[model samples]
Target chain A: MPKNTLGEHLRQQGMSRRSFLKFCSLLASGMALSPALVPRIAQALEATRRPSVIWLSFQECTGCTESLTRSHTPTVEGLIFDAISLDYHHTLQAASGHAAEAAREEAMKENFGQYILVVDGSIPLDNPGFSTIAGISNLDMLKETAKGAAAIVAVGTCAAFGGLPKANPNPTGAVPVSDIITDKPIINVSGCPPIPVVITGVLAHILTFGGLPELDDLGRPAAFYGQSIHDRCYRRPFYEKGLFAETFDDEGAKKGWCLYKLGCKGPVTFNACATTKWNEGTSFPIESGHGCIGCSEPDFWDFGGFYEALSRPTGQTGKNAVYGVAAGTAVGAAVWAMNRAKKEEAVRGHEKLTMDELNREGEES
Target chain B: MTSTEFLLWVKGTGFTLAIAVFAAGIVLRLAEIWSLGRKPDLAEAKGNANTAGVRTIFNRFIPDKGIWDRSAFIIIAAWFFHVGLFVVIFFFVPHILLIDSIIGLQWPGLPTPIVDAFAVITMVGLLAMLFHRITQPVKKYLSTFEDYLVWAVTFLPLLTGYLAYHRLLFSPDMLLAMHILSVELLLVLLPFTKLSHSFTFLLARWYNGAISGFRGVQS
Candidate 1:
């Protein structure tokens, strides 16, 4: 069972060493590492054993799985995904109820404290009956499975920040994997469904380094979530020129001016969508002439309307600003009136002085 | 605090405080100046005060021939400083955006590279102006602590902004916070100090022009 390493497996699959090295180089660059790190990454991945991965799905739409599966054709990313010893996945595995559960159990037992646990979607905590697998509640299953996991990959915004199910007044009382399991190193690949390359990139990083990648405040890999979308957007020049599309079909929009006035969240949202693109390097939301909805940010569902400008306050700040202005104006008026009275008094107290009197005053000084 | 938190504070609470102070101070200072109503000139008026006031606003921008020649370097450098400051403040996209957000009015901005060049020119011009102020005996004698305070506050925003744009000194968040905070410092000092000249200069020029033009002089 421990005989064939990744290098041997790649050779058996008829993948050339040159192609494998090229793949390593791509991964290295995608992860924001110098090209010099390619050889080290290649060596690390080559000598690595097939990491046992256990995938769990909870309250999700399965869009994340679709994003990965339909992300690209038979690319190296897919090949790497295939190379991992993925022991359990409900949609992908061909086993029935008991057989599937048995597969997960066997993999967990065999690779105890070593398997990578990948999760997509939030888990319902209010009611165990809300989401379950083979009559086992998702919460129970996650807690049980996480104990043996070396690390966890929270694959979608749902698993990372509880997504739509965990939006305001979350009915199912959904919570992210990190909320439930604090012991394991949770890597959040956050997006609406997350970028496929980012998912594969994080996996490659973990496989090569045998640890988690450097993360931002939200537990997202810093390499991918480092910069805001506006920084890399092609239409940024329009923003700098104060050219903006006020409406969706205005001349500014046609001219591809900045969508900032039309509720573009690109300025605030952090993601690689602008640089990486989607659908095999096709256009992203901003490119398609639509504004970003800030889907990657936590609780994006409640950041006011999707078409509301980001600088437009969400009610509270506006009222506060108004009050502040009123208070300031009132205080200013009072101060000005007092100062004016004092000046008038001083003016009234002034006495007329002729050249003779001024000369005498100066001489006394 | 982390750079991100520091940035949030600068953009949020710090910005709010700066705006409140600036608006209130400007209003108070303007009231003080306008309330000092000029004593009626008993002498016969030769020209219209309204036209003279308006004319003086633009006229004081130039000096009389002899004074212009005598202080040519000061005039040229002053022109550079004012023009450069105006362009950097009103024509830079970020500054324009800030103004638009606050006032609900928007205007086109100059190209980014032009604004960048003007920022550099403004910094150099300001430094040269400051050097002149300190090194020249007459100006140096008149200069006070407030002069240095205003200069430092004005210079910091430009320096920090350039550093932030090039991502030189610190992380992006930290640099951006420094830039915004420096601007806030300038704002807080604006109405209380000689920077109030931004407002008072107009009033003083108008008063001078009106008084002179009333006597049939093109001041």
Candidate 2:
């Protein structure tokens, strides 16, 4: 969504408050919060608290911020964080240079061990020379800022699992946030640039529950990453019946059958996309007629192509044909059925005729 | 009215419930697989195409070079039982009759002698499996009540099918009903049991074989 609110900007361009409130309700649900949480979310918006936040964008595309801003709220993006002040965001904050650096310093001291440190990309630790922000290396800035932060949220896959930058031949030696801060509790919300609602949902979870949701072995929240998308995918029924989409544009694909043969990793990749959805709960990559890229898992980028063969092809490529043996088996089975039927028919026919003859003899006598 | 119909209804129902019982058996088997065999951590490294686990196992499972290698006889026997059961169900006279009016196949069946022979052969093979399960020490250790239940459930259909066809020990009607009912019970139990593995075997086999394939080794 590119972090552009259709609010005052929308109002200036002409949008009604009624339409805006409806949009707010939509946003509330997008974050997967109960409708009851709406009033509190609204109240937080009406009485914006200005919670201090230090947004550190490292080796990233700024897509996370872009997604967050694109939320179709009634300026809810600005309003939600209005309760919490976003002290420094490289892309959003107008101020730069010594003034920008000065604001970060003051905010850190004021919210010491209390501020939310939102990190968007991986830190280059190989030489600390790979990525530098405002004269300080990303590695140094992260360490320094995280020293007394209340929470650290690794925003993108880069900061979550060292992402693409750490893929093969990774010269920069990028590392996820968990690798750096041993003392603090860090929430790694991974994705190429994770779904916008997931980002805010994590924030709301922290705000409402006062503790992180149960996490999986990979440290992803079990609420979202617990079940394999494949297990619950709508195409599962088709797979059970052996209906599969051989190609992206085929008839079976149009009918929404399984994409397993075309290398859909939904079978193994665990995520909420199938249920929670993307594009404002509109459609995810799989529903859009393309296979999942397994973007939610670590090292997904380096894992190779989306259409690459599955881990096992044992049953593919005529391996199951059983050829002479399979044909022989089928023929034998068919013959067996045929013979059983014929024998039963002949025996029953003979017995019926014999009984009739005996009855005839009894009648004549 | 036909031998195949009774077998289909028998097996269709039995194999189905066998699925549920099969599921439990698989979970129990997994417990043993975990304890008995060397298992690599599939979590850290996925069973992807480029990985060691999936690739190494694919060769043994996907190829046809070993169908009759004595050890392969067990698998061949398994296949025979499966094929025999399936043909008896789908291509059987009764099932055909049930759908014939709609699908319009109108195919004919084999004579009585051949049907009797197949019934006897199927029963024999099924007995061998039942015996093999009882005698194999490792399999015995892994066996559970559900496993025995599955074997019995599988065997009953074949027995009842033969009896129903022969009309040897009981009235065909009574024998046929018993056969059909037992098979139905098994079917209802399928999704909930290990017997479902009769179908899920492909998925599991593919999983293990794929892992081996990725590792560039035979399963």
Query: Per-prediction RMSD in angstroms?
Result: 5.8, 23.2
- Model 1 has a DockQ score of 0.34
Residue A259 error, candidate 1, Å: 4.1
Candidate 2, A69-186: lDDT as tens digits: 8864425454455435689898899999888989899999987877788999888878877789888999889999998688888887888888888876788988888888878878
Q: What lDDT does candidate 1 reach at residue A299? A: 70
Q: What residue pairs clash in candidate 1, if any at all?
A: none
State the lDDT of candidate 1 residue by residue for B125-161, as single tens digits: 8888898998899999998998899999999999998
Worst 10 residues of 2 chain A by lDDT: A312-321
Model 2, CA-based lDDT: 0.65
Off by over 4 Å in 1: A1-46, A54-63, A87-112, A119-149, A154-188, A212-246, A255-270, A291-325, A336-365, B1-9, B37-46, B64-71, B133-143, B167-177, B213-219
Could you tally the backbone clashes for each prediction? 0, 67
The candidate that wins on TM-score is: 1
Would you estimate the TM-scores of all the predictions? 0.75, 0.52
